[model samples]
Target: MLTNRRSTMPMKHVRMPSWHAGSKTTTSALPTYTIDNTPKSLTPAILTSTTQSLPGYTTTRLIGAIHGTASLTHKVPKSFMKSLSGSFTGSWGEPKPLTQVLYQARDQAIERMTKDAIEKGANAVIGLQIRETEVMGCIVVSVSATACLVEKERRGVKRDSAQENPF
Candidate 1:
């Protein structure tokens, strides 16, 4: 009487969501400057995409590397908050609690860098980098920049008098 017995079970398939997109990201490279040994008077040189001119000097070797670092620790003051939101409308009243403090630190770092560059007799600065670090309960902002004296090669030939002089 037990002719045939069968059990039927359904099969289920589950699919998970994906988080990858087809776009690719790329990073650009930084430029390297050649250091010069001889000290050359600082002059403002025009920067062109095709070529960069270094200071004009005989010895084109690295003389010295000057760097500046600064750190600032500050607590947000109530006075700063009052001024944060000018009488202007559509303004976010005052900066978030901690933002105002950070801004102060950034300004302090920049000022220090400027002073250091001037003291080192550097007319222009290159390879400027900045970083902000949080330690303990205080935030530390640090900035670093390279100051160097550059020289350019002098052309041998000088312009000669014109064949015909115009009155």
Candidate 2:
């Protein structure tokens, strides 16, 4: 003969890491619609990869987090566009030649961000980052940064963050 037995157990709540305590997963609410179907030329102005901060200066006040985004379709040559029938109509494989176009779009996004920073009276933007994605054969780029007004501090003067001077 055999008997069945059951044991009682209590469940414990697990906590998430501090980093992920506050996070939003939804892609921004920006309109996905494009104004002009035709792709435009792009130029990179002050979007250097090492633009985390202005050289010889440190951020004082953070104006706010600024963002700019741009979307561009593959500039298929006239010959290819004719074969595809006008603008791309659906999701499809991309041509390697389109890489340059994608870069142009990314640069355009950075340009817009730089303009926004300037308009806010910010001399430079810090922590700037660029992200890209492919959607329906269109390359979408987004630039994000903290607009800041930085002042060049005297190298000899030490920051006041220290409670006591070692010297």
Candidate 3:
């Protein structure tokens, strides 16, 4: 014969899994949106590493200088505006702070440019310059680098070596 068993205590509630905590899920808070600064007539091309090796010549590569610029407009998101009356202290209808946004943009632009130069076989970058501008409620950033190729002379074997004989 079999006997039935019953519990006197109630069951506990289990919490549901959160998407934010999972690595498989993506978050909406991306750092910086890309705004192409390339001129309309100019097309940016990727320089391949194989191209760095010149035919019939050994060479050393170096970067001459790097230049960059960043510009941003403060849109004053609705969420930010809503918090202004509570936590933020400033002019009533003023836009977001330009300094902070521009700084972030500038840093990101510079990093991108440096990485690109490195990928193109550049050894070093010098004399960096940055510029920023705001136009029609949008930010524009520009960066440029000058690259150089150098070669070292190889030493030839001395003629006297031929006179020596090995036992």
Candidate 4:
């Protein structure tokens, strides 16, 4: 028969490794939201290009492929006011609310893709592609690119005859 008894030995605290520290779950405060007034083209810290390669920079290493996507919905209004404004603005007319929504979605997708590239230690994203799809009332935008490291190509200066013969 075993008797119920508490161990009198001192308890030792075990130190966890650095990698194991993040295994514990913790509650965090919700992030604060703010309006971003900066232009989308100027927002990314990493260089992005639609072409296979950057114009003036050479790829040092390819990190990997990354992707991002976003979706938004807007009801298209058929009203006399819109037609009147469209008529005054000529054949092309003013941008529709739907178009604006699509643009916002595209910007958000690209921003997310850029953030992914940054997190992966990439300095640039090449072969960037943005695809838009309209499903029901929602417009979804997807962005894809290859994250890579790039360096500017160094060009040797052309020496003129006068400079070469300078006394």
* Top model number, TM-score: 4
Q: Give the C-alpha lDDT of model 1.
A: 0.45
Question: Which regions in candidate 1 have their CA more than 4 angstroms from the true location?
Answer: 1-65, 69-74, 79-100, 150-167
Provide the lDDT at 51 for model 3.
47
| Model 2 CA deviation exceeding 4 Å by range | 1-55, 79-96, 158-167
Q: Per-residue lDDT for 1-167 in model 1, tens only?
A: 12223534444434333543423222111111226422122222311111222345322232244343445444434444454443234855433323434554565665676567667665545555668887776677776655555545469955345863432
Q: What Cα-based lDDT does every candidate model obtain?
A: 0.45, 0.64, 0.49, 0.71
Off by over 4 Å in 4: 1-43, 75-94, 157-167
lDDT tens digits, residue span 39-124, model 2: 44564454233466677776677788888899976654455445344334475643422444555667678888989888887776
Per-model root-mean-square deviation over C-alphas: 20.5, 18.8, 15.7, 17.0
**Residue 132 of model 1: what lDDT?**
88
Candidate whose lDDT is highest? 4
Candidate 4 lDDT tens digits, 50-117: 89899878788999999999986554334523633564665675444334445666778989999999
Off by over 4 Å in 3: 1-60, 63-76, 81-97, 147-167
What is residue 13's positional error in candidate 4, in angstroms? 61
Candidate 2 local Cα displacement, residue 68, angstroms:
1.2
Ranking by lDDT: 4, 2, 3, 1
